[model samples]
Target chain A: MLNQLARDVKASMSIYDAGDDKVYGLLAEFAHPGELLHAAEAVREAGFRHFDTHSPFPIHGMDKAMGLGNSIVGWITLGGGITGLSLATLMQWWMGAVDYPINISGKPFFAVEPSIPIMFELTVLLASLATAAGMFALNGLPRPYNPLFYSKNFARVTDDAFFLHIAASDTKFDRDATAQMLEKLGASNVETIHDHGVEDQD
Target chain B: MSTASTDKTLAHLADFHDEAPLVKGNLTFHDITEIVSSHTEKKTPFAWYGAFSLALAGLMLLVGMIAYLFWNGTGVWGLNNPVGWGYAIVNFVFWVGIGHAGTLISAILFLFRQQWRTAINRSAEAMTIFAVICALVFPTIHVGRVWAIYWTLPLPNQMNMWPQFKSPLLWDVFAVSTYFTVSLVFWYIGLVPDLASMRDRAKGKLRKLVLGVASMGWTGANRHWRNYEKAYLLLAALATPLVLSVHSVVSFDFAVSIVPGWHTTIFPPYFVAGAIFSGFAMVVTLLVIARKIYGVENIITVDHLEKMNIIILLTGTMVGFAYITEFFIAWYSGVQYEQYAFVNRMFGPYAWAYWTMMSCNLFFPQFFWFKKLRRNITFMFIISIFVNIGMWFERFVITVTSLHRDYLPSSWDYYTPTAVDVLTFVGTFGLFFTLFLLFLRFMPMVAVAEVKGIMPEADPHFYDHEGDGHHAEHAVEPSTQQ
Candidate 1:
């Protein structure tokens, strides 16, 4: 099968090549998690920055390996909570104590203790709303379409498979060389997956 | 990858052939029905439905009782003067107190990270809403003027009136309503996914329409779960403090007063603790019967009941502590009226009521120290009913005993329930059972999905070898926020 594919590739490209003409990139096989770690580290060490991982389940320490850190969600929550507290306090006080302080129990208008419960409730309400809004913004949800969906086999990722892909658009491109590198690093069944709908970038 | 392939190869035969492979690796949409309904496929025990129908008929009696009370003035009940609140308030507080366990089980136990709570929390949450429903009824009618009750609200009208904002009664309106709304949203949101599962499982039109609308457009996508989780966490966080505040505000109704026994600083914590004590006990009572009737005993294990018993014991102790502290404080404060109120509570005309309150709330729950009794179904049920009795008497003693003999004795009146009070109280129980029986028949009665999620087998990704049991420290994620 490899010899036939090699012959066809050489004929289609119309470049050089005769016997033993080899294709690049071709994912050889899936990697063990440990092997994937090693390969990812090698990719980083070799100064290749663009790559992606697909796994049926999330792996521990994946974020650190991907160099992701720190969500800004906390700041949004804090700010929203502060705003809520202020708004609740102001609204209650203005309406209940400040504006129409018709003496009912002969207590002072701005009785702080009675107000505490409402204050606590508003603070939490606002903080939670902020968190939900911030989460939506950060996740970039409701996108309707994602580039990852272009892969027909990618749907299996949520089931029983694990995968890793390196794109042709990478600066370290030499399709044959990259495929050879991936195969040497222990991918299970190296194959070049074409993303047909990708833009015709010059 | 090599390690995983080798691992898969080692267990491939077992994975395909074994009835229990220690994990169910992947489940598509089709897998859900098989997972839930396989055991349920045969004709259901028609006896369960038959029993439920009988209970529903009993519930209709409660509805009839309520209708009688509403049409007639509150006079149809025995309530007059001193015992105006009588069984109605008792039932109100009783039902409200019972509701605490539901939200507590859902939110507090969840925050505490108790995985065992998953089996019962969903039903307990439903109980919370229904209990609140029973609770709200007493307050609405107890005023003796149901329609004119809106006069309490602050609205501009021809009469030029506004609710006394300083009144604890007014605060109760906000507190109870807020708690109800929050619990409802929480319970409904929790039900959505389960309802969707029910929708998927439905075969006939009845199941399809009911579940489909109830599910609120859930699609079971992973992202939906991710978002729902975050929202649920936030709700749990919000509910925790709200739970604390609700009972405290309710307590303020008595605490803020200058009336002898009614006025005390300890009321807030005391009431909160008692609410939880009674609530947990109620959950045990309900879950025990529910598990037996539903044939779901394995899902609700002895461990779950034992854990709830511990809560009942702890909260019972706290309630006991509050009682002692209030007594000591009354004596120490040396205020003559307050002192009289304390002494009168024990030896006054209503002393039988006082003793009944003490023994029921404080005395019986102590038996939980013996683990055998806590797990013993009959004894726990009896004690739970006793707690209900004691809690009612406690309210009775506080309201009547304290007020009957005021600073001016001539103005004091001995309160007693008319036949009206007795019937009204019975009707409230009718109302409570009516709602509960309906819930059991219609709803899942247990959170099937949550239970499945908590099962160790659901987490196949955690292990490579079948039944490796290496996850000794996963620690069940400790039942975190509901």
Candidate 2:
């Protein structure tokens, strides 16, 4: 019974086996930002869409090299801010003017001057939340597992290393040809990552 | 050039020549990771234990005092009719003021592209959260019946009553809560990259698991970074206005009032300046100790301290000017109550507090005008403490003295904080310190990724052979492959 349970847990964990033939992607390591940029541009010009670079920090021109447009987070923040302003203003006006009106100083029940502070505060509050949420949603984050995490070389991306990964799922992906291309582009180390889906076959 | 002009030009060049490296030591990527992570991964130091114990004791005292006050009532404090807004309000203002510097360093300075902020922004942002926590405590308890605190929010109820949207007190609720939420988000987003770094390096399985979850699977992917940088920039932009608005609204808690001392147009800008002054002082005080304890002096160098001191001097001068202008306006306007309020602040029962405020906020920081004193860690630390004390008194004098002898002389009574009041204030420091100590124990005090970004080695130009056309052509050959 214990042996069965252990086998079940191992199967659920989807541990990658060394002999697995299924390729998740090819990861190419670069020594510096310039090399990574040049490699990214080369990949872009070659018509690859499912490729990405990883570095300890954001490189200045890497976005342009990768052919990425400006992020949509700004638009989302603006939408959220407008929603908050409208909500706050309407809420205040309803409560003080229409709902349960009280004459404190004989001032109008709903005045724009009095409502400005709350409106301003709520706008900023919503805009900030939207920015964080939009960024995470756009980036497809909180995914605790990825095939790239299996590569030992990829670990240094957060510290000292830079990397570019070409997904096997890409229509034009050819494992041997991509590796050769990356090698020519001065990648120090190139490794093939096996997908989690391969574990089912094993 | 003439000889005299050449001499002046030389001096000008000398000013630019004295530029110091923000991060000292020939640090590599591995070295930065090791230096920062060691503080969290290694066993807690003896000094940390000692300070944490003291802070814990203070936190316990704070809890006890709050418990006692709750059991007894507002009478436990020295609050009476005239002096109703006593130590609690004073402490709230003081802590809120101290919270501003973090936002200034992280958001404002970041917006301006100040690279030096990388060394201190993480801890400063943490301080912002903790200080806001400390500040929020006073108003909650000051409400006396904490159970009814929900009424402060604009929630639907059977009573059909809503918070007065026009009241500055209500504005404070929106302002402070918004400030806390925004600061927390900003701080966390900044932490995501560092947390991933920690997760990768963490040894124990439990540590790795916790950090991994906290990091949200950040892989430093370029696509992720593209969005991340955009969000960070927008948050910084959002936070800049939010920071200014928060203190301005806090100032509205006084400025909008009809009270003689509190009613003034200058309160907004003056409060903001004073907030930065006191906040920087608090940062300096905490950092001086932190650097020594953590052995991070190379990163948070004397140059960082000098820069912070210069800010203190500038803001301190602005605050001093505000004081003079307040008095001048009172006299020139010839408003009897306004003039009386200014005179009473200077020469009344709270004259000692007023003088303390002046000497600490204005006179003490003037010592920083001397380059030697600004660079001396010991002197900077002492001056920072003085500034903290002065800021507290400034709030006390502003809140209490103005109300103690208002329009009606019949209700005049001197305010004195009881044991509960005094202990609660001290306990807040304990509360702040305890949270800060735990943060130091676990979280990354320095922003590793940000600091790495500013390093010369991170620059693409650092290793590029721009002058050698042959090598440049050779470098591009690999990319020419089909």
What lDDT would each prediction earn against the true structure? 0.64, 0.86
lDDT of residue B368 for candidate 2 = 92
Could you list the CA RMSD of all candidates, in the order they appear? 10.9, 7.2
CAPRI classification of candidate 2: acceptable
Q: Tell me the tens digit of each residue's lDDT in model 1 across B1-482.
A: 12333234334434323222212333322233344343333455677567666656656666676677778877777655544446676667767877888888898877876667777887899888988988897888788777887876556677654444456777777678768877887887677656655555567887667776776444333333444555667678777887887888777877887788878888888888888888887788788887787656666667677778888888888888788898999999999999998898888888899889889888899999999998898888888888877877777787778767878876767877766566656666666666676677666666655665444323433333344523323222211111
Q: Of the true interface contacts, what fraction does each candidate have?
A: 0.03, 0.72
Candidate 1, residues A123-142: lDDT per residue as tens digits? 76676667656544444433
- TM-score, every prediction: 0.72, 0.92
Cα lDDT over the full model 1: 0.64
Q: TM-score of chain A, model 2? A: 0.86
Model 1 misplacement above 4 A: A1-88, A121-202, B1-67, B70-72, B82-84, B151-164, B465-482
